[model samples]
Target: MLKRIWTIFIRDLTVNMREFMTLYMIIIPLVLAVGINFLSPSINDTSVNLALIENENPEQAAYFDDFANVELFSDEQKVEDRVMSRDSVAGILPKDNGYYIMTQGNEPESVLEYAKLLNVLYEADVQLEDARSEIIEFGRTVPPLKKMLVNMLLLLISMLAGMLIAMNILEEKVDQTVSAINVTPTSRSAFILGKSLTGMAVALFSSIACLLITGFYNVNLGQAALVVFSSTILSLLIGFIQGLNSDDVMEAAGSVKLMFLPMAGSIAGYEFVTGNWQIFFYWSPFYWAYKANDMILSKSGTWPQLILFIGIILAICGAVYALLAPRIARKLQ
Candidate 1:
């Protein structure tokens, strides 16, 4: 059975490599990761224009001005007018010796821009405090670029695993090859195992390629590989079911778009929402995957944590496969 499965897996993998869509999906993520890495310095160099109003302390004003892209304004009203007129601009005001961020705050991007400004000011203040004080401080946050890259990997792994499996199965289903395989000496378990293994191999290969191309080497290799592999299980199941259910590639492609919701939610919740709001994404498998990736990327991941995540992912996969496998096999037969 293992030998037969290997043969089938190799055949599917070879076919995947030759297929335009499959090859494209594998190449695009690596290209995007490289592009982002090349563009990131420029992106970081792009500064936020901030208006600091009513900051009478010349020492503090000079201190703030020394920070990047901050402009001091004498009149708060003029600052407000400038902010109202300009896009992606924010202002800061003195509040009880601290600072308050001022912005339109209507758009999400504006709110994020304001948050970035506050972070810069807060960091500047922290640097001054560190000079005066002896205490050390740490932040419980991941870098935004790393987080974005993890999310990108999540999308790539999940979509590619799901799409490859679905497309492969869909092709087999269309040609009635599944029924032929079922009737042959190959058991249903062997067939399913072969397909699943093929998808996993491709996903892991592509993920590692992307990681290397992006120069994201600040990660635990063994744990990172496991996390990457575990992350694709959900998508593998999704692809299997969707492929078995759909009549053709068009229907399968449309169905694949629906999985993007969870993928997007994982990134949004991780990057934007925090605290109690984060619990909303606890049920999302990609959420766990992203968190694990974040941990592994940041070099803070533990074996026990990875184990717990692995168990959780396996349970989800087990439940999904248990519920869907029989039906899929029956359909193929």
Candidate 2:
């Protein structure tokens, strides 16, 4: 039975590799991961941006770099051009041994104020250590925005696993190979397991790759993998149903994608809603998955909490599977 399942899995994998859509699905998560890493600001990064004529005011520019994001330009015109660009950047130009701050007039008040404060401090000969400021640590190293983006990517990739399964099954149906399963010494259980392996593997690989690429090396992989694995149950069921019921690739893909609605709703509720309103999202397995992922990313997830989330996810998936089993079996026949 294992050998039969392996054969089926290998065949499905080979066929998927030869197809453009499957290859695309496999590559897109990594690309998105790199994008997220590049776009997300570090926890210590300052929001204030300063454009300075470096050749004219090298010392001032060096001083400003410690407090804000300083973009050095060799000429005043370049500094003015940078300040006028889309992003909120304040430019400081030298004039008659004094400096003047230039703005596009639409920059945030805080940015302009911050640039003014930095310039004042520089002219006053105030060094950073002279301020006598003490830094306190609450021990959260990961930025919230980056963590949220990574978590969303993980959830979307998990859903994509189901899509992969649906596509694989749809291919079998289209090629008329699904009808040959029973006649080819493959049990129905073997066939299902074989079909599931590719989706599961893709989900695991993509999740891990996203984490590593996004600099989440310190995250608890065991906890993350457990949550990811448990989260796939519902998607896998949906994939099977969509694959069996749909007559073509487009219909299967389209139907499977409807799962995103609840996913988005759950994430929004978790992030935005508070107090008693939070109970409204408890019904969604994704809400629990998000909660689990959040805790995992923050390095604050306890084993009991992890277990509870996984249990809720699996219970929800089991109930869904129970409700759909008869229909799935009928479709198989």
Candidate 3:
């Protein structure tokens, strides 16, 4: 039975490789991962921008470089040019052993004040060790934007798994091979499992590749994979139902794509809706998956929390499967 399932999976993989859409689904996640990596800012990156004449005061320029985004200019005119440009940049010009803060006047008051404060501290020769402030750590290293984007990408890849299944099923139907499944030695159960393998493989492969490409190497892959695996249940069910009912791959894929509506709602609800309003998203497996993925990516996920999320996802998927099973069976016949 395992061998038969493997053979079916291999055949489906070969067929999917020959199709452009299937290849696009497989490659798109990695491409998006690169984009996300390039766009997402690091956790330590600051929003403050400062322009300095390095030759005028190298000491101040070096000090400010450690705190803000400092741009060095050869003279005061260049510094003024940079500060007056579109971007908000505060210029500190040296005059008679004192410093002058230069801005476009339209720049934010907070930025002007921050530049003044930094100059005041420098003039006072303030030392970090003298302050003796103790720092507390929460151990969260990944930026929130990057974490959210990666989680969304993972969810997308999981749904694409079901789409792959739908495409494979459509191919079989188009070739008039689905009707002959029973006549062959392969059971319906084996055929279903065989068809699912490619989707699962693609989902898992794309997910891992995305994580690695997006600089999530430190994330707990085992915990992340569990969330991804559990979330695929609803999509796979939808894929099978749509694939069985539709006349072509595009129709089946279109129906499967409709699953994104609830997914987007769930993510938005979980992230934005607070207090009692969050209950509205509990029905979606994606909400749980997002929670689990967020915890995992942030390195705060516990085994118990992961298990609870996975259980909820399975429960939701199971309910959906129970409701759709009869329809899928009829279509299969």
TM-score on alpha carbons, each prediction = 0.70, 0.91, 0.86
Poorest 10 consecutive residues of model 3 by lDDT? 126-135
Residue ranges of candidate 3 with Cα displaced over 4 Å: 44-49, 54-59, 74-116, 123-131
**134-214 in candidate 1: lDDT tens per residue?**
645364234457556755675567677888899899989888887678677898878888998988887787777766666
> In candidate 2, which residue pairs clash?
none
Tens digit per residue, CA lDDT, model 2, 1-333: 999989988998888889999888888999999999889877876479988876776788788888888898888888888988987899988888888999999987988999899889999999977898879988788888999999999999989999999999888788888778878888888899998988988899999999999999899988999999999889999999999999998999999999999999999999999868999988899999999999999999799999999999999999999998888778776
Which prediction has more favorable lDDT, 2 or 3?
2
Positional deviation of residue 193's Cα in model 2 after best superposition, in angstroms? 1.2
Q: What is the C-alpha lDDT of each candidate?
A: 0.74, 0.90, 0.87
Model 3 alpha-carbon miss at residue 196, Å: 0.9
Error of 1 at 332 (Å): 1.7
**TM-score (C-alpha) between model 1 and the true structure:** 0.70
Clashes in each model (backbone N, CA, C under 3 Å)?
Answer: 0, 0, 0
lDDT of 3: 0.87
Q: Rank order by TM-score, top first?
A: 2, 3, 1
On a 0 to 1 TM-score scale, where does candidate 2 land against the true structure? 0.91
lDDT value, candidate 1, whole model = 0.74
Task: Report the error of model 3 at residue 219, Å.
Answer: 2.9
